[model samples]
Target: MSNESSVAAEQGTAPAAGASHNHNPSPNHTVSKDTRRRVVTASFIGNFVEWFDYAVYGYLAGVISTVFFPESDRQTALLATFGVFAISFFVRPLGGFIWGHIGDRLGRKQALSLSIVLMSVATFCIALIPGYATIGVMAPILLLLVRVVQGFSAAGEYAGASAFLVEYATANRRGLYAAVVPASTAAGLLLGSLLAALLSSVLTAEQLNEWGWRLPFLLAAPMGLIGRYIRTKLEDTPAFRELAEKDDGVKAPALAMFRTYRKQLIIATGAVLLNAVGFYVILSYMPTYLSEELGFGATESFLATTIALASYIGFIFLTGIASDKFGRKRMLITASVLFILLTVPAFMLLDTRNFLVIVLVQILLGGMLTLNDGTLPSFLAELFPTKVRYTGFAVSFNLSNALFGGTAPFMATLLIGMTASKLAPGWYLVAAAVVSLIAVLFAAETSKKPLLQD
Candidate 1:
């Protein structure tokens, strides 16, 4: 069968009748179900493990802070701990450059495989580090170094996987497949929250601070291996394959991308800020925000986050389908307006100290974020052409994410520390949303075009 016939067969319907059917403006062929499944599996597993570490670090901030920086005051210790958390993000740009080069020059498969391996090694090494009481100043220093390695590897993960999904998926259904990336991230955060809640629920605070915090980090090794295993089973994306076959790889992808696509990079970077900051603050920073700042117990905080994330996961696919059916701008704009209007009120509700109310507020925030997350990866992937896709996305996404996304927790903590207000983080969310709103206003709809030609 021809490529068009294959796309129709895979989709099983026409574009108007089914959201997953071929809608590409050009004739870019996709693979069969089995190959598509392999592509998705390879993409999903790596992001799952990457975000799992992010979740653990965010959720266990209090315990980690106490164990690693007991010499400091409550606020100072938490700040120091989140400083470590924030430090990882700073390394992402460097990782993006390295992995982006590998991805653009060599292949996505190699970059992905190497990234997971490095991330896993870093997590396990972090698990083995002695606490401050055991090793003095070297403990935090060692922890910082491990985080740097993890952050570096993670820089390439979401962008690379996104390029994979976008390149592999049918024209009409890229959003649906891309939903897996953020959904897997949510799953990782949920698993981390659940584990943290369980550990805190059963163990005494002293025990948790001393030994229990190590369990999650230890699990990172096996999970990373699993991610690497799945990724190695697949070849590079079709777009990359086309480039490779033609010997069309750029000489210096980073420099070439900047020289050629600087304007597109700025636009995509602005659009990405909403996802990076909103996701980090809501999912990664919420547990800490509730327990540390709002006087909730760890169980209460984790429960709230878990429920909200579970809801977000369920809502993501529907939003993905909607973005394809509707338009990218509509979905993103709605999310931004909701975030801007609802943030201060939601933060106010979180201050109520009522369990049910907290869950409700989180659900509201999670829904808005899911709309953005569901649409973001594919939209960002579509902004650049095949040759520069990985580097453009990696550099732009990681730069925005590292500066704003990764530092969200630290920024939130700093804002609260400086202002003595628990609701200060909500304002930060507002600022990010407003920026996103402007970008979406400027961004053209990316639903039906061919990424290779874009």
Candidate 2:
């Protein structure tokens, strides 16, 4: 092949002889359809398990506060619970560096397998910790410690899974494949919301605080085992394997990312701001917001969120497909613009406190979010070359998430208290959207191009 042909082949405009449509430029490394199916499954499950644990924690934050903290003041206890939640995220940036090294240098499979086990173990441990009555000050302390482990483990899951799927995907359908990450995440949240609703309705407050909250967490053990087994059985992604074969993989991926790709790192971190805030605020924290802040019934709040999450899962696949057709930058920009124009109105609708209207508004917010969330994994994956893809994605993603995303719920509550306004979270989301819009404007479109392999 001539130099132009080689470049064209790499860009997917032309193919090297015998290179499968489902594979990249490396003809010898064609990924079979069966393998692709399995890759999707393996990539989806670990993220599912990781987010399920997080969803359960967020949904049960109220019960956990009462169980782990002294109930001298309701607001104080709830703030303490969310404080532990936010503090745990501070460990994620460090985890990003560690897992990025493993994924970029060693293998994506290794980092994913290890992270899932640690996440599940820490989550399962949360179920066994004694309440404040039995453990005194140790209860909250242990809760925070376990949450930190969970946060650290979860740091690697999203970036590794996104990289694994995108590398294995056909160039034309990478967006759809990458959307599986957010879909699985929403699935986990849906299950958590349903369980929360069920327990809150069927069990008395005493029962929920004493024992019911622990039940969902115990499922993490078997789920982790299964996620690990599936991930271990798979080989590394074709991109990683190709890099390894060429001996071109980076040795110090995190360092290289900072030194070589500072602009991409900055853009990626900024672009993630909206996802970090919107995800936590819309999907994870909304139930707490509705029930606690709006004085809605817990069961009703969970029901509304459950309905929204279900719609979100469906909307995600469509957004993924759309990104493949329309381009990621357009879809992302659309999401940001929509959030800026409509978030305050959405929150205004929620303040009316009507059950049906709240459900509609939540669904609307979730659908708008799909435009951003569904496209983000692929966009982030495309930002860096194969040499440091995992590191770049993880570090930038976790940095934004740690600083903004993890703190969103706490910030929302604090803002509401300080401003004496019910619309505080809405304003926060708008600001996040503006930041992301500016970042995405700076990004180059990667949908029509092939994966970068350096």
TM-score of each: 0.93, 0.95
| Strongest candidate by lDDT | 2
lDDT by residue (tens digit), candidate 1, 155-189: 98888888888888887898998888999889889
Candidate 2 Cα lDDT to native: 0.91
| Model 2 per-residue lDDT at 62 | 88
Tens digit of lDDT per residue, candidate 2, span 57-86?
Answer: 999998998999986787788889999999
Q: Candidate 2, after superposition: displacement of residue 187 in Å?
A: 0.5
Off by over 4 Å in 2: 1-23
